[model samples]
Target: MALRQISDAICDHLAQPEPARPLVLSLHGPPGVGKSMFHLLAAHALYNRQPDRPGLRCPGLDCAGYKVLYGMDYTADERAAQHSALRAALLDHVRHAPESLLVVEEYDKLDCPMRGFFRQLLENGPVANATLNKAIVVLESNLGYTELHDLLLRAGDRSKIAPEEAQRVLKDMVFSRWLAEGCEERSDTMKMVGMVSFFLPFFPLERRHIRQLFEMRLAERGAELQNGQLGALQWDEAVIDFLTEKVDFEGDFPIEGAKEVATLMTRYASRPLRLWAAAQQQQLAAQQQAAKKGGGSDGGSSSGGVAAAGRLRVADGGMELTVEPAKALS
Candidate 1:
């Protein structure tokens, strides 16, 4: 549902004959439920035709047309300076790349003044003669996570939660939060809230999602191996299952979602493969040195001719990664 809404919003914004205002979206959810990942993948999709391969290599803040701002980075002591800097940067960004993406993470952490800044920006009003009409603004916040989680618990399936209910609940929660957090000017805040095109709720990730994340991380690890000319890392469903079980779950959902996936993959999957690759490279180098000094193979094939593939599996009640040398051609 979130994906569909975001895609439609993007397409509609791009198709606009004369875009009156920027497409502003408010993403509400718990931590680690793929809110950040979703925006990154969305940004990648907009800029390039590359498949959404899981890894941290997405063209996010580095992209010319994409900008990300963290609310926490704006310290209270330097609030005025930080706010001006942010305002200037955003103005410049929109002027340079009209059709762009701007993601504000930790939106809930921004103080009343900063909230006012965003409120002004989202109004589509003139800002030094520059407007955000052609930009897509995403405000990521954890404001309505409790409501979202409760809805998920009741619904069982995330898709079971009605979009209308989700939007109503999340928007009400966000508005109430802003009020409680001192959104000084009530009328302006209300107008800012009304300008948002969509309030997408990301629910807790189920076991299936976590399993898919594990597979993606493993695939990314394999890509790393292949890119390094270390053949590939092989794993079956058993390996995936083993890694999936490593995540801690509460009820039907993972406690931490996919947050710890990278750490777990590095420790259990990527580390052993990396060690093997390093050892294999060292051995191949030694063999090449020996061959150069009259230590040639009897079969006339170079000792370094074979590349090894690392295979991971469940073995002896634990995990095992074994490197196998490729067969030489006849």
Candidate 2:
């Protein structure tokens, strides 16, 4: 529901031309709810022809031509440089430039005061000389459900602002952003929404979607998926159920936990070194025992069970058998 809700909002918002066909959508959600994926889908919906029909118009930005700079920690120089670069890139991407939409995921890093810089560009209308071309901007937020209330309050939002201590911090920030030295006013509602901030409501991510994310990632890696191939790698119904139980069906996931598991797998047992390592380590102890006796090689152990019972060898005069304890060694 979280992604679908976002998709629906973007599609519906731009369905009609709201002046210059400007459709600026801002989405706020917790991590792992597929916000990026939803944005890609929304882009496709903008100018896409149904697969059932050919010679279709797929309305969306060419991602290769687009530059998506994640606004995270940046020095002032880094921020300014990237900001200018992004604007320049956008102008170049949209040739004869039909309005290209810029989806700024995690936009809070671009302080609210400087937000008006964007406001001015959109509201005043980009000049032919300006770096930005005719483009709609979609500014997404990192505000998770828990963080939304605080952020809205920080943005001078009063009606739904909570009364918590965290809420107080947001309220103070809002005051700073709104009343601060750098903040500017915008008379244009559409431009304000695009350049500044807006709210995106939350929805539940059903259990099916959670599993789908993993499958989707694997598929992108060229893993051929059978009906149960997704289940084969590190998860099954039991695991999914156990995971779903911890999630807030509204798509807010145990993101930390997921990262932890992926980290553990990568660090300990990821591909090119899984059971083979464990088996090799296990064989080491057996090899030492055989070395003490010193008849069979480090790997060849006929004392153990079937594993040590290596393959059979046939000679001209008689039949002799040799067994390899470790299949990896064999």
Per-residue lDDT tens digits of candidate 1, residues 1-330? 788888888998989977989899999887888788888777877777355455534454445787888754565688888888878888898888777788989887888777777777778466887778888999998777668879988887787888888999888887787777666767766786798899998887888998889888878877877787677777778877887888898876788877878878776776577776897677768767777677576558675444467676665557554434433211
TM-score, cand. 1 vs. native: 0.79
RMSD after CA superposition, every candidate: 4.9, 14.1
Which residue pairs overlap in candidate 1's backbone?
none
Runs off by more than 4 Å, candidate 2: 1-5, 12-18, 44-66, 77-83, 94-96, 112-114, 129-134, 147-182, 185-198, 202-253, 257-330
> How high is the lDDT of residue 320 in model 2?
21
Give the Cα error of residue 298 in candidate 1, in Å. 15
Q: List, residue by residue over 251-312, the lDDT tens digit for candidate 2.
A: 33344323333443243223322343344446655765766577554566544321221111
Q: For model 1, what is the error of residue 147's alpha carbon versus the real structure, in angstroms, after optimal superposition?
A: 1.6
